[model samples]
Target chain A: MLLNQFLLLSALLFAMGVYGVLTRRNGVLVLMSVELILNAVNINLVAFGAFQDNVQGDVFAIFVIAVAAAEVGVGLAMVLLMYRNRRSIDFTEVDLMKG
Target chain B: MTSALLLAQVEFDVAQNIAFAIIAAIMLISAFKMVTTGNVVHAALYLVIVLAASAAIFILLGSDFVGATQVLVYIGAIIVLFLFGIMLTKAQLGDDDSVEKEQRSMGALVGLLLFVVMAFALIDTFGTQEIEFGNPEPIAYVAEPVDANDLPTPVREALNISANSGTVEISEAQFATLLPEVQRRVPGAEVRGNNAQIADAIFSQYIIPFEAVSVLLLAALIGAVVVARKE
Candidate 1:
């Protein structure tokens, strides 16, 4: 497969993720968007690694996956905490820091 | 060397293109649904499909280990955590259809802009460049002792080396200087499989980062526990 095809896929996924993060009211959905972005990045990394003959890209992807796991773990926990405190996970509703 | 081999390569390329197209479509559609679905649970499930398709794409890219890790970590652990979070948060899992109507058009416009910029950049940089199959050539300027046992199965087979073949130390500089002579006497050097080389890289060159990631994971685990636990 062409590298550009993978790149295009990554770009589209990233855009979708961005849209999700920007517009989604639910905090959990926001985290899912972030996961989408990260997954797109993983595709880019693995594709480049495979095409360019570099194992570093794959190694970095491993780290990315681990980090993403941790991120989602913490993110979901935060969402849970927010829900416990506010009884709602909507981003607009949880705006206590609003000036 | 024969027309049969050439035909096989062409068929392989066609198969790869078809796989890429189908997987890309699946990932894009599911990702779109993941963001736009009214039910948070359904969105998460769509994310699972997207992630699973991504893992398939990784497998197609020949990084089998990374693909497996994606499935294990992303689908198995991360999405499940998202589901648990949704359930704990009492998110309306039903088709209430109030996911998000606020700022939808603005977000889509921004996303479209970003996509255009990224697509242009990507096309400008790597237009229609296909990823070559088979093994990647060895890294330059690194002297490594190679043994048949140390070689990956594909590489060993390609090099036609026995299991007990003695170690041969070859540096990039030495290879370059002796290229013409070596080419006359021997076939090309064996290129290790992605899994083998990745293992070598992580344990050798990237060991510190690997350890650091472990520490990071531990900290995240503890931090998540502390944050989510009720007082």
Candidate 2:
């Protein structure tokens, strides 16, 4: 496959993820959308790594994956905590800081 | 006889093109479903399909190790954790009408705008540029001397053109055609597997980042436990 194909795929995925993050009110679903965004970045990194003559892109991708895991773990913990406190995880209703 | 060989190569390329089309179609459809689906559980399942297809794309790109890691890490560990999060939070799995807000149309507009911009940029920059798949000419010019005898005999046979003059001078088209055979013989050309190269690169050149990632993981583990623990 050409590089353009991979790039276009990642672009579409990233856009879809962005839309999900913007529109989804459920906290868990928002987190899942963030995962999609991260996966798109990973795809770009791995594709570049494979096309070029360096392993650094792959290394960066590994780091991205690791960071994404950590992010998801922390994000979900926070979501769970919010659910426990508010009895709901809807983004619209969790406006504790609203003045 | 040469025509027979050419026919086989054409068939292989056609097969690869078909496989890519199928995989990409699946990924795009499921990704669309993941974002637009009403059921949160169904969204998660669609995410799994997208991730699995992306992993398959990684494998097709000749990064088998990354593909496998993606499967193990993303689908195996992370998605399972997501499911746990949903289940623990008492999410209404069957009905998710409340998942989307009134801003959905605006979000779709933004998404479509972003897609158009990104796709245009990618095509404008890379429309005519083709990926040079497996040209070993640069390796002979740049790499430290490799002992042909040390390579597996079949791998040497696959790349024997480079063995004679220490540099293969094949045309780009010929090299492109020969890439799949060489990749089938060895995951990484002119050396050991890509996994080995990636490991060497991590431990040698990027050791600090490696250590940092480990520390990050440890902190995440502790943070998750503390944050989710009973008060």
Candidate 3:
């Protein structure tokens, strides 16, 4: 019962995150969606860790969190730099790199 | 007869199932809101809800340690970073009319299709099985009593055993027992003293990744400092 519930919720969250990543023009919202995806993955990790009676998955989840923190740090810095240059945070508008 | 036997073998607890259903519902709804909401700050707040729900699910799954870590690290630290990013970037506080509606509609369709496919895959994989929850076997080594002759007399005496009595050894089992009691008394009990197997695996096999995490943290600190540096 619990595993099914968790799996369903994780799928839903990941789907919502995909929608946000694809549809949202704002870079900040895209970052938030990325976090959503990461959270969904973490839920799956912890659930399976508990089910399989293994702590290694939980440990890996912790590593994922660390990597996520680093990713958000670098990603947000880049987003801020783009916002500074373009005066807009929308991805549609920040196509200066596109040839 | 086989179907009936299978049905009898599967035990579903109503209360737990209902509770999990509620938590799952809240998680999905909050996540949907987090993505769909037009306001950035509102989206962050909804993300907090989603994280909290995931943590709750973690606790329900019997990994209290990972669940608490999820709440503390993701909700407390990472979301704060996101909010800071929004502030630093000075994102428009209101919804913009210039966003492409047709693209968003297409993306929603794609997302919905992906959701259905993933859901079907999960159901196909796990639908026939029953999930049972209980205390897992401790990964630490379990100690068994050694022969009386193997232990020194004094050590045997301290364990309230006669020279003829089997040696009551203090091995991984003894440490495992003591560690949980200590954890109950002392908050944030480190797993170092209790589980030697875990320690060995972490220090020997995972050492590189551990150091890499530290390096990543260092990089993040420097990056944040550079980004936040005053012009």
lDDT of 2 by residue, B80-103 (tens): 999998899988877677634558
lDDT of 1 by residue, B1-231 (tens): 699998998998899889888988888988988888889889989999999999999899888999999999988888879888888888887764554455898899999999999999999999988898764444334456776576555444444567797886544554555443242332245545678889999999999999999999999999999999999
Arranged by lDDT with the best first, the candidates are: 1, 2, 3
- Docking outcome class, model 1: medium
Regions of model 1 farther than 4 Å from truth:
B1-3, B96-102, B136-192
Tell me which residue pairs clash in candidate 1.
none
- What TM-score does each model's chain B reach against the true chain B? 0.73, 0.73, 0.65
Better model by DockQ: candidate 2 vs candidate 3: 2
Q: Write the per-residue lDDT of candidate 3 for residues B147-213, one digit (tens) a residue.
A: 6666544444444447676545555433444434332222222334213433554577888998989
Evaluate model 2: give its TM-score: 0.81
Model 2 iRMS (Å) reads: 1.2
Candidate 1 fnat reads: 0.92
Candidate 1 chain B, run of 10 with poorest lDDT: B179-188
Q: How close is candidate 3 to the true structure, as a TM-score?
A: 0.76
- Highest DockQ model number: 1
The candidate that wins on TM-score is 1
Better structure of 1 and 3 per lDDT:
1
Give residue B170's lDDT in candidate 2 (0 to 100).
39
In candidate 2, how many clashes are counted?
0
